[model samples]
Target: MAISCSFFLFMVFTMMDHHVGGHENVCEELRCGGKGPAIRFPFRLSHTRQPDHCSFPGFTLSCTDSNQTLLELPISVKLFVEEIDYISQVIQLSDPNHCFPIELRRLNLSSSPFQFLFHEQDYYPRGYGLFNCSQSTDQRNGIFRISCLSGPTHQVYALDLNDGQSLMELPISSCTKMYNIPYVPEMGDANILHLNWSTPDCRHCEQRGENCRILKNNNSTDESKTECFPRQRNHAKGRTSTKLEIVGAILGSFLLVLLVFAIYRVYRYDKVEKENQAKIEMFLEDYRNLKPSRYTYSDIRRITNEFADKLGQGAYGTVFKGKLSNEIYVAVKILNTSKGKGEEFLNEVGTMGTIHHVNVVRLVGFCADGFRRALVYEFLSNNSLDKFISSADVKNQFLGWDKLQDIAIGIAKGIEYLHQGCDQRILHFDIKPHNILLDQNFNPKISDFGLAKLCSKDQSAVSMTTARGTMGYIAPEVFSRNFGNVTYKVDVYSFGMLLLEMVGGRKNTEVTKENISQVYFPEWIYNCLEQKEDFRVFVEDDGDAHIAKKLAVVGLWCIQWHPLKRPSMKVAVQMLEGGDNLIMPPNPFATTATTRTNARIPAMDFRQELQVIPESE
Candidate 1:
């Protein structure tokens, strides 16, 4: 009876092995046309291949009657597949209908796993051309009258004319069609657009002699991501690789179980064995070279006197007064454990550990004991610059225009040090009056490295996942990649906002008595400067007035909408130091800087909410 059962099972296994082998053989084979290039794996011939054999929905290739391979995209646009390079993972596609240029704007691949293949050598800058206008206006000096579609009644407005302005200001009032064409629109026949796409990303796996197979099925999309596994080696003629793999896997599992049992016994001997060996390696890697004194949870309590003297509180953490020695005073900030990824603690330690400057705040030590984390810093005598600034009142606490100018220069110098002085360029994403601490002599020092990012000095931009810094002080580029990538200029923009705040003696956002929101502080200040208004800053003499104007002009220059428009921190320092002769910058508040009149914010109450202590701890 046992012999008969074994024979029956052997027959079933043989049949299954044969079927799998046939499928593998078919998958490895390439499909080709009479004249077209051969395609395989990611690209499958829909007629010759089974639905389960294809990797993705959009990757299927169809052969035409004339032997041309056609690729129909998700957008219902069909293109002739000229070439496919599996090595580079690129598919060359050209519109079958040569008359109509592919609407590049509408060619979105957000849902697909492909990206536009843009090459610098073959790239061409394009501009919009408004054509077939019913009415022709007087702004038609460079507007060419297109006689192809219609007679002289149709005018084609090109961006090449009139200082490269947008189609938003098009003179043709009744334009029927607007299309974005190559800058040199005369070269009609040479208008082949190239796009590159990447997906399945299995080139490396193929290089390692591995086969890619779908692990999970996406029932809704009818496609799924592919995973790679090593190809099974054949053992003999009749005996299949599947049976050998199963027997070997069983033996390996038994050995693994025995090894794990031994390790468990050893681990039990030392109960405090590393919770996660991988996480320990990562922790060591992140803090390899950085030297900050790590403190225990008890040490934090001892330093803060059991949370006795509270200096200030914020959304993230609370600052407390801690004494290191008889003469040494340090500000201890205990972070809320449940809030963030604990990146703020890492940022302050890693960034501030390497720097030493008067204008920039100093980092003394840090504590990262389990979840209880705290940061210690040299406490300033005067808390922050926010207490000194108020639009409604500044009579007794007026620092005078000259003094304020000194403070601005000091702050600028600190930022310059952070940018130019450090081995790596450090960007203080949060740069506002609240973050700027003052000394007894009223010298401004930049504090709060929690939101700071460090990048190479030569690096043009720093990549960020989410926007950092206060909402009012955030640069436009930080919020949207359309503005530009986040760079050191982000700090410059924030500084510009801060400088304007200092000059205006008010928060940037305000709610009017009539419930209609007024212009932003920077806009209001820019208008005041443009019209040569007094700015209402307490100006005792000509020097004070000159100082205020200088601050305002530099402030305006720093807050230019585009990153390239704003000067570098080095140049900004020069401008701040170079007295009286600074040129008035152009209006930075272009059409993009729109006012939100409906936003009802209690500006004074908000400012008062974050008011750091005026006196030292």
Candidate 2:
């Protein structure tokens, strides 16, 4: 019984030691305690800890060795955590030193991701000490230039660490020319620490109980301050010396303990990272079956040819121009890792994969390699509709009265197809000129089906919790149902805005003071028809006044405020093609504020309106 009890106690002690040693092993491997000040997470050593998430992955800390207690990140960036406010979710870090070959002073401010935490404070430059060096006087006394600029001028230097490297480089001449000294009292003689000095400061020497002396060089005019070396005290010979050695050992032991703890943290971080990669790979494998095709990161590099030519960027991704084969050109859209909407990518790919339409841009293929997701589409030479209509010079060349009418008709037909032609009704939440791409022949192709939603064909409109679509072009029903219940007619409202823009040769909302008072443009177009006046904003030699009147009438017919009153896309297409004598549209902006509020239209039953037929038929 005695032997068994002894063995059990030994096993328990061994288990305790093993657990404690596991943490110590990590600390020792990293050597974090010896490096510098140790900072741990719920904290990060750098601002960019991981791809998108703000805080460091695994909430690990870093330990570094410097005058400032710096935390070295896994990415090899060293940061000084000045303050951490848990309540505000803010961390203030000191400006990093620039030691690279590149003139890092400029790069520090612009390149570094660290942002200022203070609401209104601005960053400034670091100040240097200035001293008046004369041959007669000992080069010790000097003025510290703390606050130089007093008036309304901005603060040129900041004392807070949040300032970053805005003012990193101190002027070398500032030490001599400004006749100023640093606020730190231990910085011996200012002259020795000055740009021209060769020796150390004497005030530091005096603090160590050494005499201050001056060294003069034959070729140099400036005098350098030097300190007399101190003799070491022998503990065996004195009682005071013995006490100091014991105290030194105690401090050293404390530092050793901290160092061991730091190293353990780093070791644990490496192990965790490896485990995380393995789990991510397994998760991706499961997702791969659902994804159409798996492209390697190497394949992406080969396809993009090292991101040779960047097309443009948008909210979700960056576009790159690349050739898939000898004859085929494709636009590669690389999803930004910072955007946390991975589900949206899957939605767009899955939806577009099943869709094939002449007026819609085709998705050739896609790439899902780890965190790097991309989509490949057939390249459109003419870019987007915004390029042509938005430009003052280009709008006339590609978009004339004839072509604009054809484009408008084509767009309406396309939306009509999505509503009734497809197996499922696809609600394009965003409809604007920007989303409309043009082919080589100036044909409008609806692009960017990212915000699309698939609903039943029988439903007149799908209930939406959040409002979507571009401002100004959005239907009145979307903001308030006083206009009408939300339906696909919202698209008609946007189509109306686009039609008006095409007719006016510019955006209708962009009316200037020169034109605002003189019959609000859309209203003016309506009044002109009422009086049978010529409707022409731009009267060039090639312009057709009759065609302009037809487009204005069709645009007014589409934007009737109430979805019930607005024409369907099929009707809109017929109206665009129809000659004059189309029925007059009701005034859209005539509703009184009181009546609009009181008689608000309730939620729509999409089934009832889904059977709408073209009125022209």
Candidate 3:
């Protein structure tokens, strides 16, 4: 019994030393000068000086030879690091020459991890215009002059966005609009920029006067999560002799108790882990019954050439470009270990193994050797639909309006097949442009079945323990039953949003990085439908306009918030494959604000007035 206690004591001390060494080596705080702010975790000295684990991915700083600290943001100019308040997650930055108006004109922080410190209610910072006016111009309320940018007769000012003034409303008499500072909060000192991060959220911990650091876990590979504790950071230089002695005394006592508890916990944990491993093995054995050809882990390595050529990655796994034959290419998705124990692996394999549609991605093979799992799919050279869509961004318009119409039709047919052609009903809970892969010829193919749920054809609804889907595309019904039960219509709703994105140059709800005011894409299209306008997209001829109008109308019909007001995939396919005389869907957004359900629109819910789309909703 005495020997056991001593052995545990030895083990405990060794672990403590190891823990101290791990943090002490890489995350030591740095100083550019005696008065400079302490730089530590989430703000590394440099990649060459510190490991990535010691700091956040993009937050790297450099110390100048003259003892000045420089912090680079997305903008062209590098600002001097004035101070970093880890408590508030805010960083104070200043232009070297104190000419921020010139720097602010060129600054756009949307691409960077930082954002201007704005109130919670304010979704984002307001836009401001920069102008240089004559000294004789209308008297200004506040003077934020940019001396470097102004001449003897002119003074530069960044309009105070909080004052609710526009460029036209500005007293720009004898003033020239130099540039526009699209987004910034009103600061007391215009020369200083205060930017903050929402992540590495240490404010709560800091408010409690506890130190925040990466949450240490032996089991987890993810380092993104952080937690709070009493100061465990190892800055040997910062430690006082008395403080070190006190910490050592406390640890000497605390570690004895912790080690005893840890020994008992480990025994119990090992038993549970063994049981889990056995259960997983049983599940793998059952996977042998699946229809797709089973390949060993070795076969996967050979086929993928050890994952040499990379393709892309998504939520479930990383895809690598592979070659099965000299003539045939494949995309192999190696399932992420963090993805819950074999559930997503089983979901994709079981559903896709039985499917065969031109518009659906083909499952060439799969690998489930021991704990390793991978899925092989037919290679599509054109990549996912997301890259090809978004019109204004595409200079040449890779897929013309005619081709987009065809791709939309093909996607509709694929979804229609999933709903009706399959032996059992398969509801693909996720259907976004990213999941829609394009062939060499630009034919649409639906992929990624990890979120799909199976039900009997006769069943009216399937039970869901949790909502499963990409945000922005998830159906209203999935979030609230008040919208109705989860059904095939969920896919219809997502497809509607996808159609709208393709028609518009951007996402239906996407905001410009510069925060330019643009109407919502769906709302814009809805207004166009009501006004009998051509949607103002780049159009070559009347035929293109007709096709675009047809797609937009069908999309609006399919996205009626309530499942009861959404058309089935079968009806949607008809709408796409049909002629141009399709009547507009009833305004679905009218009653959204008042009541989601229980509000009737007098005989015009989901295509009752129109001959097509089948009043199924």
Off by over 4 Å in 2: 1-294, 391-398, 508-521, 531-536, 540-543, 592-617
Give the alpha carbon lDDT tens digit for every residue of 475-539 in model 2.
Answer: 87778856656677888888887777676656544445676553245676777776887654554
Per lDDT, the best of the predicted structures is: 3
Worst 10 residues of 2 by lDDT: 189-198
Q: Could you give candidate 3's per-residue lDDT for residues 1-617 as a string of tens digits?
A: 44676776677567655554554554666777655888877788863446677778668888777878898877567889989998888998878877676676677777787877766876766666667787534335433445566677767666656665444455667677767675443442456778899777778777887766788873687656788767555456445554566558657766776777688778788888899899879756753433667889998889889889989877778999888744479899999988788888988888999998999998988998888999988899999888777664465755788889999999999999998888887889889998999998999999999988887666647777689887667888888988777778889999998998888866544555564344245777887887887776767798878888888988888888777778788788888888557766667667655444534523234532211111111
Worst 10 residues of 1 by lDDT: 601-610
- RMSD (Cα, Å) of model 2: 23.2
TM-score of each: 0.48, 0.46, 0.49
Better-scoring candidate (TM-score), 2 or 3: 3
lDDT of 1 by residue, 145-264 (tens): 433334565654443332344455555457766665433223323334454555666677667767665655556553446667665554233345655665565556556655766676
* Model 1 ranges with Cα > 4 A deviation: 1-291, 509-519, 592-617
Ranking of models by lDDT? 3, 1, 2
What's the lDDT of the predicted structure labeled candidate 3?
0.76
Best by TM-score: 3
Clashing pairs in 3: none
What TM-score, to 2 decimals, does candidate 1 have? 0.48
